[model samples]
Target: MNQRVLSGSDLAERARRAIPGGVNSGQRSIPGLTDLVITEADGARFRDADGREYVDYHAAFGPPLLGHNDPDVSAAVAEAGRTVDLCGVGVTTAEVELAEALVELVPSVEKVLLTSTGSEATFHALRVARAATGRRLVVKFQGCYHGWHDAVSLNVISAPERVGARDPISAGILPEVLEATLVLRFNDAEGVRAAFAEYGRDIAAVIVEPVPHNVGCLLPEREFLRTLRDECTRAGSVLIFDEVISGFRHDLGGWQAISGITPDLTTMGKAIANGYPVGALGGRADLMELFSSRPGGSVFFAGTYNGHPAVVAAALATLRKIRTEPVHEHVFRLGDRIRTGLSEVFAGLGLPAVVTGYGSVFVAYFMTGPARTYDDLLRNDASMFVGYRRRLLGHGVFELPLNLKRSHVSYAHTETDVDRLLEAAAAAARAQLADGDVLADVADASTMGGVADRC
Candidate 1:
């Protein structure tokens, strides 16, 4: 592989003049990297602006489950573009077909409402819950990121001390918006019971990620999940499973199918379209009908690009491929292999870290044991993990910039890629251990902004 002599820093400098923070998303900007500009991606690898190729585990923040630029999905999008570019006035056949596919595949989805992004899906789902239950408060577990909407955006990455407090991560979020949201510790059945006991009647919905990946992949205990379902049913509140990241990636029916705990409303995106900008809100027909543009019902759900032809076609192709192929099997096998290999590598290096996740998504926590809640994750040596991630990047393993974000294995990934990742992890661990004062060095690096602060 010949490297091209392109300058990523030069391109980033130019982008900073035009865009805020020189990136479209805040997480794209790494602390120590000169430039994080990706030029091309195919299968399991992506090429940077400098023409450096690396095995990508970021998966474009969990969208490219089939890997970037999959041939079938691209071909479907191209064919749809030739037929119809945009039909804003009327619904297209592609949209109709995609909705049918979603209804057939997802367990709780009886009626599907299309949206342009995950944020829109979550926002509308919350609204529908509010309308159905006639309540204003929403209960969200801490560390589970539904999206960047005002209602779900609060307390995403709050400090350990602010677990139950309504602390908004970003500025400009109104206090009233934060008040509507009740942040609870994940896997805390007692806390959930207490919240419902205090404000059960006023709660519109209880939204959760069945397998929370936002704060490094914490799986819910069976008791905790059942408690949410029981509590919501008792309180007449809608249970919204924000499966934006876990949907279709774990199974055809999402994690709900595996758990047999179907939510009243399900918000799905990311892997649903295999990198296309698409989202869906679906659940019990009675609840979903709140968003209907019919005579009596009114929820006000509208988006111009809700089901753009090309995007729908891409989603259709991706879903059909997953249905017929061994996609889940391949991803699961790779995930197990990677986890085992990484565990062995860390144990051999005498590093106190644990790999946590389910199915194809995983994260390396610089802690001795598994984390059950957001505060438990805060106990991790995040600075040390950031240094480890940077070292892996140097060795051609491109993980997401955030230390706590989950890394995914796409169907395109192979055993060879897993081996390469293990090799890089071993090398990185050796380099970190070479210094006697590694913890002190990591603490110093933490002072530099843009290092393991954001979720």
Candidate 2:
């Protein structure tokens, strides 16, 4: 593999002038780009701009469940690209096949609507929910991000000071958009019930991540999921499960399958198309009917690349690979191995860190206790965990630099890859402990400023 000729910093400087924030996405902009510029990836490793080889846990930010440049998907995409440049507005055989496959595999979804990104799927889901229920308010949990859309982006992660109160994280989001959305605590049944009691009549939908991975892979209580289903039904509020990060990572059907509760609407992305830019929204027939574009309902949804043949081909191939090869079981076993290794490594160092996750995704929280809610995450030593991310990169393991956020273990990761991660993690922990200062002391307390220069 060939590395970029320019250093990471020089490349970033060049990119910043051409692109926003010196990166294409928010997560791609780490503290500094001086050391990282990905050129090529194969199996579990990525070659940086400097041609440094790294065992990658980034996994293209959680879409490469089948690994980067998977032969099956690449071949499928290539064949499809040769057949058609763009499907455009017309129907295609590939789109129908992909939708049919999704309907057959995912128990709750009867129909599917495709989009170019996770944001579009979520945005459409909210529109469907509002149209179906004829209500105005939408409920979401704090710290669980659906997308950058105005409706889904409100108070995604309130700072520690705004723990119990609602506060929008971004500016230019209309006050009306924030008011229309009701932000609540994650994993709280009482809060759900109380909100329903107060705003049930006006509530259009309750969208929740079945496993809540955006805030450090927080697991939902079984009863809480049941409560969401029952309460939404009783109150005539549509239930939506946002499975952007969890879809096909654990079970092929997603977290909702393990929860045993059906939602009115479901949004899926990330792992759906094996790293291609695609997403899907689907569920009950009655609610999906509102999107028919017939005379009556006005929930118009359209995208230029909604059912792109190249992306659809990739998705079909990825789904087929998951079914035939059955990578989920292997990834689960490997996930357990890595989690246990991190736990043991932290325990040996006498650090109060915990490795928590489900399926192939996990997070290392530098707190004494579990992170059940955003408040719990705020109390955790985020600075220390981020420092660990930086040190691990120096040792050739590339996980996200943010602490208490999503970490990945892809199908390409071997037992040796897990060993390398645990080794780097142990070393990172030792480095943090030797510094003697807690992450809270070492880090700036403000939320608006940029992260310190690292890596």
Error of 2 at 227 (Å): 0.4
Task: After superposing candidate 1 on the true structure, give the runs of residues whose Cα lies further than 4 Å from its correct spot.
Answer: 1-6, 436-455
Cα TM-score of candidate 1: 0.95
lDDT of 1 by residue, 345-415 (tens): 99898898888788798888888776888878887776667777777888999876455777999989988
lDDT of each: 0.83, 0.81
Compared with the true structure, what per-residue lDDT tens digits does model 2 show for residues 1-455?
A: 99856886687678888888777666567663333667889988889777788888878768989888899999999999899878466688999999998898777799888998888888899988888778899999987778878887755556677766666656798888878999888889999999999989999999998877766678889888899999999998999999888888878888888878888888888888889999999899777778854446578977888889999999999999999996998888899999998999998888887689997887888878766877777766667877777778789898866645668888888999998889888888898778735444333332222211101
What value does the lDDT take at residue 363 in candidate 1?
Answer: 87
Candidate 2 regions off by >4 Å? 1-4, 292-297, 436-455
**Residue 444 of model 2: what lDDT?**
37
Which has the greatest lDDT? 1
Q: Can you give the TM-score per candidate against the true fold? A: 0.95, 0.94
Error of 1 at 261 (Å): 0.3
TM-score of 2: 0.94
